[model samples]
Target: MVFQFDDLKKKTILLFISAPLVGAGIGFSFMFFAIKNQPTLGETPWRTYLNIGASDESMLQKAIRTRVGIYALPKEEVIYFMASTDSDGELLTSDQRYEVSGIAPATKIWSITLYDKDFFLSDNALNRHHFNASSLNVEQGKPFSFVVSSTPEVGNWLPAPQKGNFALCYRFYLPPASAFPINESSLPKIKKL
Candidate 1:
């Protein structure tokens, strides 16, 4: 059977009108699931919220560069706060997780954790992997770099979800910022590598 031009036009209009209703139905379904299921960090991933650009390359390098008063925080003081950072376009596989490593000369304590899109600690078996500054076996002489990956070789690592995006949040307390440039250099730097 063949449809005439006028019949086709009517069909097209009907499809257009029905399309929005279909989409609304799907949207409502998602909202219901979101309310009922309540996704977790690894369960839904968090990389979707990140935005990176090469235009800011120089600016980022500048942020990483050493500057005056960069490490001015008091070493004897304990500052408690959770700071979040993002990775470029580096996608993590299901087998991968997160690992953060850094050195503190005189800091009494420090930790890095992963959170879901909702800004809550990831709901995982390990209860959100976190390693204190003293608990880490970081190298000496220079600031340490931690690898937040799904499948890290060894050292401090945070397990991620099976297949979804995620984020990192670092908390420093009584950090040796005066001696180290963590404040100036930004402890966690996102990478696509």
Candidate 2:
């Protein structure tokens, strides 16, 4: 086939514009899926722990972490356990009620905060957003338990958006040495009711 100079220029221009658009689409798709499906570093069946390493994170891992809002903090100083689903492996929605139960162990402090699917605090009638060890009224030698739901509940209620998926961030500040190498037993169980 014979090609004219004018035709070739038009094709080149089309290639230049479309190539970036295609590349960008693919890049965005990859990033979205990568972050969405990325496995947690130290994951149990109910909860997942993010291993914010001091160094040696790949570019894709870093991108995923950034997208998920994993911030800078020394592992020894604090540990984070996150859950977006119930023990039944169902995505957590405010339509159902959930219970999170576990002993705090001997940590300096611990807290559980509720966040919407977008990782922002949800707006609700109750201004309450989080509950910490200090704020909770725990009887000595008794395990701690809390309810997560859109409806009001007795005792340690963590509010959730009335009509969307939500997540829980369990933070242990200045955790003890035994808290390292977390396992299912060490983490709280989140069960849907």
Candidate 3:
């Protein structure tokens, strides 16, 4: 035995069921788009989220910043640039070898850290994932370089995951105002070799 509802009751039921579903779909898409095309400020391969950790940041920007595990510092104090590709715009993967060379600007400190696709340190035997001002072969005001590979390298080996993709984050502490829109060439050059 089946009983059908009147038009008004049926409309109410439909709204109840569809409202949440529609809202959920809209919300998920909004977040996904925001996170995927996340507003950043830079050229290809290396970009920094706009207003990340800034007082005037939108909620979405703050959320993206937190998701990426960046330490909150006003842009005036610190800035970060992330790259997931080589110089020729190739997606950086674990299987390839790369030579990363750069000269740090006159900041309090700087570092280059490697992260897996999940935005965490790549797992490797050396337990090494980054090289910073204090941990490089070159001195301040000089060019520094390193290698990113799954296999051990001669010097400055920032490990890569054995079987997945990865990214690199360059952080500058107490960077000067002129450092805005950090120059692409100024940042480490990741060349597939």
For all predicted structures, in order, the TM-scores are 0.42, 0.85, 0.83
lDDT of 3 by residue, 1-193 (tens): 5565687798999999999999989866776677666533444467775475556877766656677655767677777778888877788998999999878677748888899988888777877888898888566668888899888888788889987889999888888777776665577788999
Ranking by TM-score: 2, 3, 1
Report the C-alpha displacement of residue 4, candidate 1, in angstroms: 52
Model 3 has an lDDT value of: 0.78
Query: In TM-score terms, which candidate is top?
Result: 2
- Ten-residue segment with the worst summed lDDT in candidate 2? 40-49
lDDT of each: 0.46, 0.76, 0.78
Q: Can you rank all candidates by lDDT, best first? A: 3, 2, 1
Q: What is candidate 2's TM-score against the reference? A: 0.85
Clashes of 2: 0
Q: Which lDDT value does model 3 have at 173? A: 85
Off by over 4 Å in 2: 40-53, 139-142
